[model samples]
Target: MKKEFRSGCPISSALDVIGDKWSLLIIRDMLVKHKKTFKEISDSDEKIAPSILSARLKLLESYKLIFKTKVPDNKKENIYLLTEKGIRLTPIIIEFSLWGNSNMREFNEIDDIEGLNSDKTLIIQTVQDNYNSMLLNFQ
Candidate 1:
């Protein structure tokens, strides 16, 4: 579906595009874990179905949250990279992760997220730098 807003409400607008669990999970994999390829995303612990994963990837791309590009020196392979819009979602994802970790035992904190969150500038810079490094490798 194209960028169809249910109303002028910001929350509903966002939910219309990325309210689904699969969408958020895919975003989480790319943003938090830096998963780039379809295979990498499929290998996540949640084990999402292949068909569903494919659809979510396409949807994210359509929403301009991510874009697909050919892997350098590998014409047959493509990788997903987050767009600036996606990068801006970093804080929201971090907060979401922290909230989940607070209640769930299985979802252990994997990174020093508390420290990252405490220092907003450092976290944003870290995410931007990481993306920049990944982009450099493709060039």
Candidate 2:
């Protein structure tokens, strides 16, 4: 589906796809937290409403950020996995984490910045590698 955008600018076009309040968090849940199913995602710490979560999942799928499929053992249960496009958001997620860690510390107690000083490329690569490795057995 051709997505309607508010403007032709690259940032605006990108936001047109993932600017919603819930979309990035959903991607973070899948990409970082490794959430796979509707139930698993819904049961996350964010406590996203079922209706909103359903809509966000469909929107992400329509944008080609994630694909839904069922594992062989449970054809009735659907699991969502990131596409290459979605995996590309890893750096953004990492950046957001660092930004939050440095700027939003008053709101959150997670001050573990041990890896923040590490080579950023290495951090992003590690996440991508782990995600790809996990998908090796995904049918």
Candidate 3:
């Protein structure tokens, strides 16, 4: 039998996969910084444990939010790529980052909120449009 969603709300369903703090941070690292490898992800300041990183990657893959492929030049290493479903999350992540930047004084010192917010709307729209185009290509 197929698994069921927790609810009919789209946001809730999205949260089911990415609501966790670590999961979103991982996605942020991927989308914002383009960090793909396990070592790169684990080395983030968040200090996610190796075991947890492995588990989260598996879970994200299971949810079809990410897919793993052998690195082009390194057969021994795998690179994680976001699926269309995952790419659709770009706006949500950006918004959260913007919100945090606005609310957290310390975060402001580290993040370039003026620059980020200046292009915030455009960035979200571009991501959505590009992701839609990618989905069409997949189809």
Highest lDDT: give the candidate number.
2
| Model 3 local distance difference test score | 0.78
Which tens-of-lDDT digit does each residue in 45-129 have in candidate 3?
9899998899889989998888898776678988887887787789888888778877886644655644576687888776666
Q: What lDDT tens digits, residue by residue, belong to model 1 across residues 1-139?
A: 4766899999998888789888888888887678999999999988999999998888889989999999888889999989888888777776676666556646664544555435656766776677767767876
User: Ranking by lDDT, best first?
Assistant: 2, 1, 3
lDDT of each: 0.81, 0.86, 0.78
Model 3, position 49: C-alpha lDDT score: 92
Q: Which pairs of residues collide in model 2?
A: none
Clashes of 2: 0
For model 2, residues 8-123, the per-residue Cα lDDT tens digits are 89999989988876888898888877889999899987799999999889989998999999976889899999999999999988898878877887877875855776888998
lDDT, candidate 1, at 53: 92
| Superposed model 1: Cα runs more than 4 Å off | 106-121
Q: Candidate 1: lDDT of 15?
A: 89
